[model samples]
Every structure is written in structure tokens, then in C-alpha cells.
Target: MLIELRPGTSAEAAEEVAARAGAHEDVTAWPVRLAGRVFVVVSGDESLAHVPASPAVLARRPTPDGHWLVRRDSGVAPREVTIGPPLSGPPEAPRQVGVVGGPRLWWAAGPCALESTEDAVETALTVRAQGAHALRAGLSKTRSSPYHFPGRGLRGLEALAEIRRAAAIPVITEVCDPREVAAVAEVADCLQVDGRQLDNRPLLAELGAQRRPVLLMRGPRASLDDWLRAAEFVFTRGNSAVVLCAGATGTPQQPGFGAITALRARTELPVIFDPSHSTRSASLVAPAALAASAYGADGLLIESCTKPERLYRPGDAAHMFPPESLADLVATCERVRDSARSLEVSC
Candidate 1:
């Protein structure tokens, strides 16, 4: 492992960084310490760039304001590790399932409305209060008809930025256009690729260039291989924090085939399921969520509206379960997760 020191800093701190990076020789690691901040690099090769030849060599320098990612000749390359910690953070590897905010509930609420700026904040807060780890909003809505309502453009994105400001949990929104990737990167913590936009390879490539965590949703008609290959579009772009999402499919079955299981088995990337969209009904959301967990899905995303019928939206069937239903779903998911753990121990 290689360690670099900033211009004015002494070589003493580099030793500490090296020690931290090589703390576990079982896993190859690289850490750079400058001032009080530490930047880590994880790659397939053990050789790290230890000299400050250029400021551009730093892979990422994310600020509280905006990200400042520098371009370099050679940077942190991709590795097929099952788990790792954040680039610049504590040494411990993060747990597989990140709860909505706390506990082991890996749930995100997808509120499908962008009527007003106030509505965005209200909906996000509603989900966050109900133990949701993230707020999933759609900046670019894929409506059924050509005459249907789309998004509020760049103005709506500001609303999502505000929600992130007012809350502790992360805000996730979709970016359908390839051009919008840069703009969306400025605000949203995570970018979600809509099911319809899965076929748009260039857009996925552009999102990968931004080097942010992406939620790639499988298309309703797209096959499992098609979906995993789509993920490679991002992986090859040098972004490894890619997650697979099992969205609704166009199957004839009422609940649709268990595409979630097939997707999970196909890719090593963490898999999340959109139960709300899969069933398009509050009643079926629970069953779909259970199925996803049974098949080893990483998380669940359910559309939670304060009032589903009152919303000004065309996809009302997908929106179900007020705040109470979210709680119930969490409890049931916990039961299933515990059962799976027991089975693993017994075997």
C-alpha cells in the first residue's frame, strides 16, 4: 500500500496513514493523510501513488458545498471486493444493510409527487420520520402519455437539495437525461436510473463518470443479463458503487415473476426492490417485500404517501400505505431477516 503526504505536511503523518491502511494486511488498503482529514484508496494493485505530484491525483475531494473530483492519469482502480469502507472515513467496513436511518431496516420511501417545493419537503420529512433511511423522489417523471406531466426541471431539483439540507438522511432522485447527470450530481446524494431509461446506455455512462452511488433499476421488459450488462456500463466507467434495483416488470402474472431473485443471483452489486411499483397496490407491497428479502435483496423501496388518493398523480395504484404501513413492513422484514440468519447458522 502507498501513502501520500500533502505539500506542507511532514512525513510523520504519512506513517500514521500507512499504519492505518496496512492495519489489516489480509485486505489491501491505501490511505493518504493531510492535515486532519484522511483519504483512502482501495484498488486491485497494492502499489499506491505516494507523492503529491499534482492536486489532480486525488480521486475525490467532496466538500460540504459540492464535490471536487480531479482528473488524473491513474487513480483508484476497481476491485471485486464484497465490502469496503468509505474513501475518507473510519477504518471499519460498513455493515451490509444500512437501515433507513437507524436499526436494521433498509427501507427508502418513494414519494411520486413534485407538485410544489413545500410538497417535496413535507413528503421527505414524512418518510424520514417513519424510520426511512433515504427519500426517493423523481426529478424526471416517466409518465404514461405524451401529454402527461413531466418534472419541474432544474427548479424541482432545488427542492430535493433543500430536503437534504433540512434532514439528516440522504435524498435520492432520478436522472433520465444524460445531460442532467452533471446537474443532478450537484444536489442529490444518490442518483437513480429509471426503469424506462435503462436502455439509454449513454446516460448510464454519463452517470458513471460522475462517480457517485447509482441505483440502476431493471426495465420492465429488460432481461436479467441485459440489466447486469447495463451495470457494467457504469463499472467500466470507474464507478464501483453501483446497486441493482428490481422495479416492476411487464409480465402477465399479477405479482409478476420473481425478477428480484434472478437479479440478485446474477449480480454481486447490492440489490434493492421497489415493492410499491412491483405490485402497484398497498396490499401487495408486503408480499413483494417479503419475497425480495427471502431472495437476499439488500433493501426495500416502498412508495409512502400521506394520502395516496389526494395526490395529483396518474400512478395512484403504486402509491400505498401511509406512515403506519411503513412500520408494519419494517417489523415483518425484521422477522424474515432473523429467520434467514437462523437458517444460515443451522446449515
Candidate 2:
């Protein structure tokens, strides 16, 4: 069990929370501080009812999956994770699911990896003009095959920083290794964890400690409960700014649109879709993206490039769509969202 004290909780209140929790037989309580927030973690097999009836207590919840993210979806509090010092933040508070102006479909379009400084900048600018909220500039990639071209390392991070500067928009990038979390957090407005890295407790804990907004992709074989439990890997440490990313499931033919709908009914955290990854085909991405929105995805991370065919890894073009198509899809998503809202409002 974890007891969350309100933000700016005083030391006395924290100690009191710990002391009261400690008084429970067979349970040990400790004070924890992370991501600039304070909370008490009670370790035991059973829940306690002796919680002090004080205003200092913000919430008390059980971490049944050994994680304490079991909060109500509608109880999301307003918070912001500053991207970085140099780059600008989102136009508005992001990660707020299903809000006015549409779903939290903060569009992010870019190549799977950084090709060149010039190409990254151009793609970022084009996507921003196409109504994207951020640029998906990956600094490092974990390829499936050993012979495939792995991404540029530190150079990629530097290039991404330059992309954010030139494009003047927030950047989202992947952190493949735990050791590089600090460096990646400094450059990326939001940190991304690949579906392959869902069980990387070390990496997720580091990201949680780094205190940046994280976009955690759902593992292909993991259940919805597994997905939320993985998110607890971050939330329990302190950072509350998390967005659940739904990707390809076990089947090759279908996207995780069903997971998106089910997750919508389960958690309040912003749920987004990665059509480019789910379908792995430029042609299939368009329909998959629309279906994700219709199924209640809060945002999207669409793979795009300046001219994908000209990429160093030409085979990557199979999954990347052009920026013009991204613009068309963005506009169409608005209309689709409007229609869905109308039906809900009337019914």
C-alpha cells in the first residue's frame, strides 16, 4: 500500500503518515520522495484502516500488482512535465485525456531514427505545420536483427536538440538504455519506452526518477493489466506524467485498437496509438490511425519522413508515410472526432 500526501506536504505530515502506517501490526512503512512529490509506502500483505483522517492525506490506495497506480481515471490532476530548458513545452497541458478541442491526439511525426541534421529538421518543421504537437525524433533504436543498422548514438541526441531548436517544438525520443536516461531526458520533451523494453524495471525506474513525461508502449503479448502494472514501475517512484501507448498485438494483421478501447475503460492516463508500428505499412497506417481515434485513443505517434525512400535505410520506407498524408489524416481525425462527440452528446 502507498499513501500519497498532497503536493507540498510538510515534513510533520509525512512523518505522521509514516508513523500511523507503521503502527499497523506486521507492516513496515517508509517515507519516499521522488519527482518532487512525497508519499509513504507501506509494505505488507494486508490493507490498513488506521489512515489518519487528516486533510494532509491526499489519497490511499493498494498496489495489488506491487504498484500503486490504482487511481480513478477521472481523478487526473493538472500537472506539467517541463520538456527541457531550451525547447518549448506543449501548446497546452498535454496528457489530459479526452478533453475539449478533441481527444489528446497530440500528433507526433518523424522518421524511426535520425538520418541527418538537415533531414530531421525538415521533417520536424513539416510535421509541425501538419498540426503535430511534437516530433518523434528517435536518438537510438533497438533493431530486431543484429545486422540491421543501429541508430546514431550521442550524435543523434545532439541532432535531436538541434531539431527542437530549429523546429521550435517539443521532441519525443526513445531511451533504449538505462544509463542514458539523464542525457535523453535533457534533450527529449517526452521520453519513450519501446514495447520490447516494458519489463526493463531498471530503465523504467530510472525514467521515473528522471521525472519527465513518459510514453510507455504496450507489449505485444502483455495483457491490459500487465500494461498498467508496467506503468506502475514509473508511477510508484514519483513521476505521475505517463501516457500509455498501444501498439501491435500478437497478430500480424490487426492493430491494438481493441486494447485501446479496453484501456480507455480501465485507466485515465492518456492512451495513444502507434499505427506505424502496429501495421508496419504506410498503406495500412492511415486506416489503422482512423480506427484508433474511433476506438478512443487519446493521441497518436505516426511515423513520417521528408522523403522516406531516400532514407539511409531504404527498407524503413515500408512503414513511413509522407508528411502530406499526415496532414490529411490530421484534419480528417478532427472531423471523425467531432462526429463521435456529437453522437455521445446526443445519446
- Candidate 1, run of 10 with poorest lDDT: 65-74
- Indicate the TM-score of model 2: 0.82
* TM-score of each candidate structure, all chains considered together: 0.68, 0.82
Tens-place lDDT per residue, model 1, 1-347, is 22334544444554454455445545444444322434444333333323344432333332221111111112321212121123221223122223221225477785764555565566667777777767777788777777766776567876676766665457677887898888887776677887778779899879878755788787788777677666655654446566667867766524433775564333445667888877778778888888767665667877876655556666663556676568678778878866875676432
Write out the backbone clash pairs for model 2.
104-298, 105-299
Best by TM-score: 2
Cα lDDT tens digits, model 2, 229-300, are 777777755677787788888855468788876765566667788999888899988888888777766778
Question: All predictions: root-mean-square deviation over Cα?
Answer: 11.2, 4.8
User: Which whole-number lDDT from 0 to 100 does residue 243 have in model 2?
Assistant: 79
> What's the C-alpha lDDT at position 11 in model 2?
85
